[model samples]
Target: MFFSKQWITGAGLALALLGGTPAWSADPAATTTAAPVAAAAAAAPAAAASAPASLDARVQDLKGDVIRLNRDLLVLEEELLFPASTQVALFVSMDVGKLFELDSVQIKLDDKLVTNYLYTPLEVQALHRGGVQRIYLGNLKAGKHEIVAFFTGKGPHERDYKRGTTIKFDKSTEPKYIELRIKDSQAKLQPEFEVKVWQ
Candidate 1:
């Protein structure tokens, strides 16, 4: 008979499931009166079953606690690995981009190709709905550098369109952040892209 461990440990508890000790164990009191022994015998199985249920609920709660702790540790690890001081980040946004359907974006720093990203249909929908996208994150020396970004998408009358914009800025000891913004030019009836640096 493979009895559960919780049932064994409950022997010393208030219920005294097996009348002070388990039946198989050596105990002088094992030969108790029939009435009290019969009552203990009936109560033992119910107590044993309930004990495991409570223990299983506690185990489940502990698993939840461990999962939450793991997530917190991961967040702390990311901050330690990519501290704000040396981090350079770039984000892309739009201001009522009525004339452009974005397809992709390419970034270059100091004439070196850094990253090229292609947008999905849902990503384009998110951007048009005023969501900002982080285009790049990297470190750079504290000096002057040039950044170039290429925009490729469909233009007016479903025409193929491509354009490039550039900026010259000085990276200081602090972190650098740049926003690539695409805005609708109501006067020209076209989309205009610009790179704006955080002051």
Candidate 2:
């Protein structure tokens, strides 16, 4: 009921390759004529050669169809699971993170732990390079909600540092987006944590 695109494509190609071309016969009288028989014999090899090419084209067409189908399925699944009316997404980003070496993040929604994500060095570098990572996506009722985030890492002077930030926002029928940002404070020579709610 839920076969992946890769599995379906592989199985379809295997079936096509195994189903060889059917055999055809010419009438005995037709074969008796030298000119007609010679023509038919010459065309036979050409047809055989073209058969594989035709099958290959068909397999390529099927692959395209599978790719489109997979994309559609993912869109449908996301809509069903997290409708726009109640969807809430949280993202994490860093800006000029020279004072912090991020290690992990913990998020709490309405005082309940929602996510605790540990970051690898590559992921930290990506954030430093302006890549925004979606840390959570789920459904929340249309009302006021609170979110708390804790950022743990090494701060200026290579000292262990942890900071917590919180935000209270109201959600409407439209989707809600919240971004947790980490930035270096040049004036204070430390890392700053902020929560930005996007309208």
Candidate 3:
């Protein structure tokens, strides 16, 4: 009778405990709350974004430099195909109407006096025949040079004129002809000239 009474008491206690348990245990409300919290936690990493702004700027700058370098290389290749020559031509055209050749015509190449003439009106006429006057510069060195022409006008005074041109000498070439076109004879202003060196 005692053993049977003990077993009945234990069974009754187990039933009572099961009946009085918290409602959340079976309703799943706690689990639902925990699911949303876990989702929010998982999304938190997205909020911490990465910009790398400095790295982006550096990449852009490098890209620009590469483009510029490519253009420069193309130009260099074209120029290399027809590299400059050692020989060049020096040409000058002047107005004979306003300032008739009065006398001595002098020109200097690179500070070295090349031509000096004595004044004579007849010398101008002689130049047409190449019998009296010819501006001659023999086998000049390759590189930059300066040309200064001096002439005496109708007046008894001396006047100075300048024409600056750059000369480039290449690896294996003789001088090609150069030209100097005179501008504004009446004004006697500075003149612009171009020299081409060919190989």
The most accurate candidate by TM-score is: 2
TM-score for each of the candidates: 0.68, 0.75, 0.34
Backbone clash count for every predicted candidate, in the order shown: 0, 0, 16
Global lDDT of each candidate? 0.85, 0.90, 0.51
TM-score head-to-head 1 vs 2, winner: 2
lDDT of 1 by residue, 5-51 (tens): 68766654533654454555445555465558789999999999999
lDDT of 3 by residue, 56-146 (tens): 8899999999999999998787456534454333444443333343445556767777766574556555443344233553554565556
Write one digit per residue (lDDT tens) for candidate 2, span 1-199: 7889788667766754875221222345433565676799999999999999999999999999999999999999989999999999999999999999999999999999999999999999999999999999999999999999999999988999999999999989999999999998999998999989898
Question: Which segments of model 3 are wrong by more than 4 Å?
Answer: 1-93, 126-133, 155-172, 179-199
Q: What is the lDDT of residue 88 in candidate 2?
A: 96
- Give the lowest summed-lDDT range of ten residues in model 2: 20-29
Residue 193 in candidate 1 has what lDDT?
A: 94
Candidate with best lDDT: 2
Cα deviation of 20, candidate 2, in Å: 30
